[model samples]
Target: MSINIDIRLKKACKIFREGENISGLILLQTNSDVKHDGIFLTMEGAVNLQLSSKTVGIFEAFYNSVKPIQLVQYTVEVVPAGKIPSGKTEIPFELPLKPRGNKSLYETYHGVFVNIQYMLRCDIKRSFLAKGVSKSLEFIVEDRRPVKKTDREQSKAVSFRIKPESLQNTRDKSNVPRFCISGKIDSLSCRLSDPLIGEVVIESCETVIKSVELQLVRVETCGCAEGYSRDATEIQNIQVGEGNVCTGLAIPIYMVFPRLFTCPTLSTSNFKVEFEVNLIVVFEDDYLVTENFPIILTRH
Candidate 1:
């Protein structure tokens, strides 16, 4: 009897944010004569963060800076060591990352997140042994939020990230999609005139007939949380804010992203990253929020 075993990742091409969950399916097809206990599937990772500073002032004072970020990875699996007839099967797994409190700054401890990788193999000496196929994924990340207000004036700011990533040797990219401001709202926080899950608006004054459109602002990229950790710098950040407004008012905004494409690279990764600190005013009504940051990328 003869049999064929092929595994393919079905949902691996979807977009993902850092703070959220990563779920996917693996399809297995077999037709000939084969017997294996249980099939196998796995998730692996390789992380890196790099930073550098360039100074330009009076003959080399302080001018500018640049940083680098990269990741290299692959996956494999194995099945039970037995043999039997042929059939089809599917497997699923979730890949999760810890919440990074800050970027790679201060010291080289927090900014750089490198984890051990795993390997999975499937073999049936009497059947088929597939252990030589692999794929590569490379992508960039960056986002932010800012707020400032006064008794008479209100200022608001917003920030996010975008750059096509190179994955599986295929360049699938997303554009500079605006963070439209989408989020959940508590029923108790709703007023008669306000709809739940509304747009982020600056409405403290009556003179302007309309509220201002807030764009993501660039704060301190590669900023250290101070004494907690140290880093070389590629960690990026962006922020958005509005001027002075009332002291006890609340504001909300939704996060929006561009449509998905054929490539595995995601355009806006809001849930998967860690962001900290802002000089702007943050409202009390914020049940949940997503931020974006910008970064410099070079294709090799």
Candidate 2:
């Protein structure tokens, strides 16, 4: 009996993400068409690091060191029946990862490595004599390690600052406010400590509202003149003034609401007119990167 063969591996090298399946193909061939008994494959893992050090005086300062890690093994096998013609084919297999050593150097890192050495054992029986053929394949497995502690610790401790130094509100003498609402953010901090801007805004309609005293009330519950309202509201005192407006007040704002008078509702025309202001603020940190916002209102 005569046995001729051709053997090749899909790749002499392979790579995998831990926990993912490691797979590849094995190619086998026969010459002049021969009957084959079966096919089987197996793999093993090994890790090694070689280091060199210095020598001092007459004695060797340090010796060349070699570290050999543990080995893990895996195996797969498949058999083809009856006589087969000479050709080539693939045998696919998988590799499942089990956790390695627990120490830092023992632990896997971005470049941690594993070497896979494999063997394909073929046992063929023909006529009165039996013969076996085995082949070898070598592969490399690399670890794509996750981020470590040092990187996370470096991202905390944020700082902030406000620009321009002054916050201003400019308004006109109309029923609505007459001014520009502007301010700058210099410093703001959060638990993560990343310097940032939290919340900055001009209350606009809700920012600052002035109240006038109600002189009297009308029977028509919804449209009475300034003097015709259910509430008697008046603001006659201002402790601090800024740019034609009061910055601080001692007057109890609740005392100026429609509730105090319990009279008819004021004219809807007053409510129909909306207040306008330019809301301007810059949100930034010590680094100077920022988001600039603008607030504008147009009356048609």
Candidate 3:
């Protein structure tokens, strides 16, 4: 007899979040009456980081290996594996998705170097020489919290300034800057659903000011020969000046963080994930100035 299985979630989409209920139905169909040792289902969530190093040193290279780290994990058994009669059967389940107290549930992340995921597995136990059937489903989990006044105090605004002569002294590029940008954000701690608000002041250089931009950058690091790397995407941009920038000019800053793509800053022994606010300045000579401030993204 042919057997088939499918999972049905109470919600329309498979999307879910922490501190939420996960309730669903397991549908089983068979062409004829089927008997089994038992049937079971399991739900699991985990964060795994793997690092391999072959270039750390000759001795380390000889013993190069991947290290696995589990940042979060949750599991539950839905049904204990014996069953028979079946044209179709439905088994329902309800489970809370949060981990233990004080342990934050990380957002689902999949990277070339690290992975965080959640899933459900179903197994049909069979007797004799028959093989047991199994199936699995993956879901997205987002974790967000309310921001408190205490969280605001943890982030401090960073400020800096630029001079026109600083741009001309390319001879001492290491010490001189073309333009100086100084600003104060409302707070460095932000939510994925909240707007980032701040003000920026620019000191004009010899060249005409083109535009100013803000970027949300994600940096992922692993214990590898290259160490760590970064990816930056523009969040917002506007023209603050046309000709030379006038000193003491205030430019208002506003940007909404995307809820679906942004992940909170996280760190582990073998891997680290972080987010930052980047300010980019462009001049007529194609001269550019960039300033960065480390920021923490939290649900709360």
Candidate 4:
């Protein structure tokens, strides 16, 4: 006989804010009647961290520092020791979404090296002779606090100009191509729900422009008093311009922050999550020039 288990959330989006209630149902189906023990449902949230190859050796000495951090954990018995009827049976459940004691709930984030996740699991126990069944469903958690007016008022727009003289870490200034790029970001503080807005103009260039692109980067740091490992990785790259054409035309910069892959900037004693944006200009010769802008992300 075959048994199947499915978990469905009342909210189709499967997204809940902090302090909210996670309401869902557990559906069990089996071809034939089966005797079992008890049915259990668990809700868990955690932050997992892993060091990159280069940083692994440094952290190997302090392995326990990188262990998964349990933010929340709760288990409840959905059904007492009994037999699940054949055909189909539905069990409804409601779990309060809160952090354990002194711990806090962070937004759900899926990243390399560092990840924060929330999940719901259902387990069906059977007799010693029978096989057990279990299922897990992932959900997203968002911060519930509102953005303060002071923070919003502090947001400021940034204007920048990029030229060879402005470049950093340039080995030979003579070999560097001549180019003048100017742009303005609407604001350094960005709301998660809004798109990053900006515009760039290529005023003059000695070489043909091949492409202009935008790169979103995530900087994650994990460590302890012994040491710390910080890694920066690209989250997404978008092409805003292609081919050598008008020199003075303004190019618009627009990018919607990808969900799950990004969350509000976070910092704690154990770790931190930050974001940055890079404007890249590629020449016909494949030589590239890049300008970096650190940004603060928030959910207002």
Candidate 5:
């Protein structure tokens, strides 16, 4: 006979805070009566790190540095060895969200080189002659506390003017197209719950403006005392202007931080997660001018 298994969370969104309990149910459906050894449920959270291609060979000797760190793990038997009738059966379960030993629960983040994840797994043990069935479900974890008022009050807005002369890494200044752009970010320190707010204006340009885009980037660092691997990757890109024709027109800047892909600015002994924003202006000839801003993210 065949058995179908599914896992559902109490919260439709499957999001939990640091100290909240993870409550869910397991649904089992079978065409006929089935016998099982037992039903087991396990909750696990971990932080996985990997070295970039450029740093992989360098850390080959210290492979453990990139090993996954277990933050939490709990397993319990939900049902004793018994027989279940045909049709559907629901088994409820609740697991406390607590860190193991001295480890602390960090916000769930999905990045290129670093990832924090929490999963719930259910296993149905069967006889030696029969195959066992299992299922896994993922959930999100967020910080319990918000950013302090002091930190928010201290946040300062930053203004900048981007011109050919202001651009960096240009081998020849004369070759760069003449352009003038100005913008002001409301604040360099931003809350994870709110959208990033800013405004930009195109003052003048010698060449036709092709596109204006805002790129959110994530900087992940992982390593130990011997060495460290740091990499920056783009998380999302939003186009604010396309085929720009008018000059001196203000363009609003707004971007929502995507969950699971971003977390509060974090720095630990083993790893660090930071963020940055790049304002890019592309010309008709494909030449682009970029201005970068390092931003601090908070839980508030």
Candidate 6:
């Protein structure tokens, strides 16, 4: 006889927050009567950090590995089965998802070098010598932090000024060589679905600007005592200006943050996720100028 298993949540929504209760039902189907020792279900959730060494050194490459740092994990038994002689059977369950003390749940994130995920898994126990049925589902955990209102006077515009002479010796010189790009974001906070409005001004007579683009970058930091690594991904890129842009020129920038690829800023003891607006300017001389402005994202 063939066996099938299905999971259904009471809310029918996979999205949940901290301190929330997850209630669901497990459905089992069989073509004919079957006997089993017992039935058990397990639910596990945690943050997995996988790191790799990009260096060509043999020792460094050999040490690279995937390290799963657990944020929270819990398991429970579902049912004690005796015998099954039915076409369909249902098992109900409830699980509590709680964040650590004074800690918040981070939004689900995925990147080339890093990923933060939360998943629920269900396993069915079968007799020995037979493979057990298993299934897993991914969910989103969002943290809703209280945002302090900004004063009317301080909400005008947030400006970013980058100068080549003021850069420190440890800074990467290849990004900002001989040009200054100053920009202003309309506000310091924005919703994930809202559009970000800003303006940029380029000032440099020696360098000929070839193109200017705006990028929505997500910076994910993950580690725990062993070592820490941070990676940034350009989620969205928009061309705002092109051609010779020198001798004082202004460009207007507008970009909409997508909900699928973007997440609100969050921080935990194990990891943190942050978002920023980056302005990249390429000059004819092959030099580049990058200016970044930090912005907070909220759920609408």
Q: Residues 1-300, candidate 6: write the lDDT tens digits.
A: 767888788876687777788888888899887777566655555556544354224334223334554555666767666666679988888888875455445666666545667777777667887677777777777656665465223346887776776554536665655766677889768776678888888866356778888989888776555555677778989999887775566688899887546776666555667788878877787666667777777664
Q: Which segments of candidate 5 are over 4 A away from where they belong?
A: 146-154
The candidate with the higher TM-score, 2 or 3, is: 3
Q: Give a tens-digit lDDT track for model 1, residues 152-268.
A: 131122332211231123233232222222222222111112322323333332221112223322122231222111222232222333443432344554322211100111111
lDDT-best of 1 and 3: 3
Which lDDT tens digits does candidate 3 get at residues 1-300? 777888788987877888788889988898778778777776677666543343245334222323544434454556654564668888897877776546666787765445677787777888878888788888778766555566577666645554544343356675443556677777788776688888888744444677777777666665545343333344445444455557678888887776445666676544576777777787766677766777888865
* Candidate 1 wrong stretches, greater than 4 Å: 1-13, 34-40, 48-79, 83-87, 95-300
The candidate, 3 or 5, that scores higher on TM-score is: 5
| Candidate 4 residue runs with Cα over 4 Å from true position | 148-154
User: Whole-model Cα lDDT per candidate?
Assistant: 0.29, 0.31, 0.66, 0.90, 0.90, 0.70
For model 6, the run of ten residues with the poorest summed lDDT: 55-64
lDDT of 1 at 208: 16
Whole-model lDDT for model 6 versus the true structure?
0.70
Candidate 4, 104-192: lDDT as tens digits: 89999999978999999999998889888999999999986766665576478889999999989898889999889998888878888
lDDT value, candidate 5, whole model:
0.90
Model 2 lDDT per residue over 1-300, tens place: 344333343444443334655455555566556665656555544434222122122222112222344454555555554565566554555555443454111111111111122223334444345566565554433434443444344334322232223222323323332323323322211111122222222223223433211121112111113321122122122221122233222211111112111211111321111111111222222111122221111100
- What TM-score would candidate 3 get against the native? 0.67
Which 10 consecutive positions of candidate 3 have the poorest summed lDDT? Answer: 58-67
The candidate, 2 or 4, that scores higher on TM-score is 4
